[model samples]
Target chain A: METDKIHRWHDMGGQPAGEIKREEHDFALWEKRVDALQVLTSGKGYFTVDGLRRVLEDMGEEAFETMSYYERWVQSVNQNLLEAGVYTIAELAERMEQVQARGETYGECAGSGE
Target chain B: MPHDHHDHSHDTDGLSPSGHPYRPDQDHKLTRWQAMEIAMRELLVEKGIVTAAEITETVEQMDRRSPADGAKVVARAWVDPSFKARLLENGTEAIRELGIEPGVLKLIAVENTARTHNVVVCTLCSCYPRNLLGLPPDWYKQRAYRSRVVKTPRKVLAEFGLELPESTQVRVHDSTADMRYLVVPARPEGTEGLDEAALAELVSRDAMIGVATARHP
Candidate 1:
């Protein structure tokens, strides 16, 4: 579920993700996490696979198959992070702590040596 | 400073006696277009074109793969004569042996010395060695840094607190469409007893930019 305005962003990409009516649901929170509008406004987000696929299609890069949309999205997002001037040793330490917590809460990470 | 798009050559502008922009073509030069591009990027961010969190996540992901330890690699080469030759012949592989990835990053290490100098700038769309350096500094992308770093390298380096000798060659690296540059600054004096981390401490960000030399700790 997404707000009407946020839904419009997905719709504008030419292929909306079904009818997402505004409701207090987990998808609403996920929508917030994956909101392209939010990423764009932040001046520091990357493109998503589904989201990037639509953007690539919009930019006529539909043939690009070298890397997944996820990888592409990550690249731009990393650039924005640097552009935002937020990487210091202390800040990085805190971020690592978050990852450590995420590993504990969620399933084992890709390289956590489960 | 508002500058005419055309006639960027410093010679014609009557600023420098040399026909070239204060920095050479290889050196990074900051111009109005670059500034506008930065502004546009910021605007896109504000308009939800991208987000900060995503970038941070990407960085965390990449850090595990290819870490940036350019200082360590360069310092090793400076001390070891054989490795220096190996580095010159094959930069990517030599650095990769240290666990820095060549697959994800495109790096060009230029040696800086009394006779030869190397300066770097991401001239076209800010193409950088992301895997190696994490994220480039704001100054690396700034038009002022890009343009001046190449065109008027000596002056720009001075601003960054670097003063080179008159005879020292100032080779400005314009990171145009292709690759990102890392300057292998010559070893400083009184650093013989220092360890790798101590040497790295002297390797300032500006030193990598090629405007300044690494200081001895």
Candidate 2:
């Protein structure tokens, strides 16, 4: 508390307004990532069929009797992106960095002292 | 496919670039590692990021091509019933007899039966028998394929132009860590009397998926 009182906190009104805008963008980016990841299987995990099913049961999640939930989600993203001329694997990596950058900027402004 | 070095000493009898038909790199069916490497090399050259000479070290880094190893083993298995039984039992060791590495770990060969066809998919990651089958397909790496294969292999296969008869069974091998799979594709009927080399030619990679049977007369 004493150390906090000693240092001057910068005014962040202008930046905080921009922070809200950045948050919206960050959410949009994450939506795309989730959209991308959900439809497809990067097959990069401890991803076993039984294990996934067990988790669903444990969480009491509704069993979507279709092809595993995220698998089709990922494909839909790919198909959509492909139709849009941007369905390649590179989109995931590119979106991730933008998401992180937006998140950090938002956190910085949100923590700024009044 | 261009062979300018040999052609230089020979004929001037060639026409327009018919010998080298323009084709998409992805359509080339080159191994993913090779394709990716070639793409990277071309990109670097185009961007002037690396000189052409600097690419030499990266060029020779390929380990092997596709399942020429598995094909040899399958061909031998066709000729030798004992070997077929052994292959059905232990694929890695059986494949090793043909002097083909079955990859670094234990490999499993699941037979695609007449009643039911099986396909393998590693839902979590791009886990594959790189030493056996070489690099996997780009579509294989897509989360779409990995996610749905176990839960909806038949449906997925249908999309890939595979159809199963109503009487046929469809068991999906959800490949996980410590295990890898290759489909011990059923031998086609018409090619029964063929020699091992001829049989090997018919044992195409897609046959391993139990999708399209090997090309035969």
Candidate 3:
């Protein structure tokens, strides 16, 4: 039996009054890449669009509300990849460490590539 | 290993800001999640699960789509009654006729009228019609929009500078699961002479999302 684990603000029933901020669709370079990565993975049959939705739906209400749009996409991709056994959590954590270390010394080792 | 392997310690209690907060200073750097995604993507390509060319090609394909596609479709519907009827009946089919593929997800066109207004929201996640409208704007993905829009449709719309009459029923469409919704706002008056392309110019992305109406001539 499937259950709704997380209770999000959007999950609330009935009407409430509030403000909505409006902005242009100016995607940062990383955001654009993440969007493309999502569609590409889905297109490659690595995961279905529905699969991504399930990951998003499973997120805690707080995380869902607080994270930016592409952040949510990144979370979904990470969850999907792990579920698909493309990479292990230990492997991902180690890789993150490596990247962080590289990023720290990138300025000295090589130009920041500005 | 069991699925619980990935469920290792993640501090969900940490309030990473109260809402959808974007970093303007770190524009050049990638977020932690973005870096993870990059690492995973590279690993996948390294493992021969997918290819860089495939991802690049897909990105190019997505880039080709923009609000202009939706604008063109909306503009044509304003001038041609039969096309409007088709759009209302079958969004995917209607869009396909215009050479714009609606992609895998189903698109349902909701028409806004004097008596009723329509808006789209995905409470669970941001499931937009990217095949036609390109990427969703920053605000649409925020907690402020997602959490509020579904609950207070009229109030939220009002905040966006769209106030409805007391009698008008504001219908908020929660885009769940497979189907996506696109709101076809009622054409504004005083532009009967405008051609299709000219009429398209009047349709903004906000109008298609039902936050505002078409710009009047």
Total clashing pairs in model 2:
19
lDDT string for model 3 (B72-129, tens) is 9999899999999999999989999899888777889999899999998876567687
- Write candidate 2's Cα lDDT for A4-114 as tens digits: 343222111111111001000111112223322321222322133334333433332132323333333333433333333432347444433433343333223112111
Query: In model 2, how large is the Cα lDDT of residue A75?
Result: 37
Model 3: runs farther than 4 Å from truth?
A: A1-18, A23-25, A104-114, B1-30
TM-scores of the candidates, chain A only: 0.31, 0.23, 0.72
Write one digit per residue (lDDT tens) for candidate 2, span B99-169. Answer: 77664467787776687687776665555665566545445544456555665666667776678787888
Q: Which candidate is the best by lDDT?
A: 3
TM-score list, all predictions = 0.49, 0.49, 0.80
DockQ per candidate, 2 decimals:
0.03, 0.02, 0.25
Off by over 4 Å in 2: A1-114, B1-63
Task: Report the poorest 10 consecutive residues by lDDT, candidate 2 chain A.
Answer: A17-26
Output the worst ten-in-a-row residue range by lDDT, candidate 1 chain A.
Answer: A21-30
lDDT (C-alpha, whole model) for all candidates: 0.50, 0.49, 0.74
Query: Residue A22 in model 3: shift from native, Å?
Result: 2.7
Candidate 3 residue pairs that clash? none
Q: Candidate 1: list runs displaced more than 4 Å.
A: A1-114, B1-57, B62-68
* Residues A1-114, model 3: lDDT tens digits: 433445544464332424555644445445666777777777778788778867776776676557776788788877887888888999888876665556533222112211
At residue B96, candidate 1 shows an lDDT of 70
Ten residues in a row with the worst lDDT in model 2 chain B? B20-29
Better of 1 and 3 by TM-score: 3
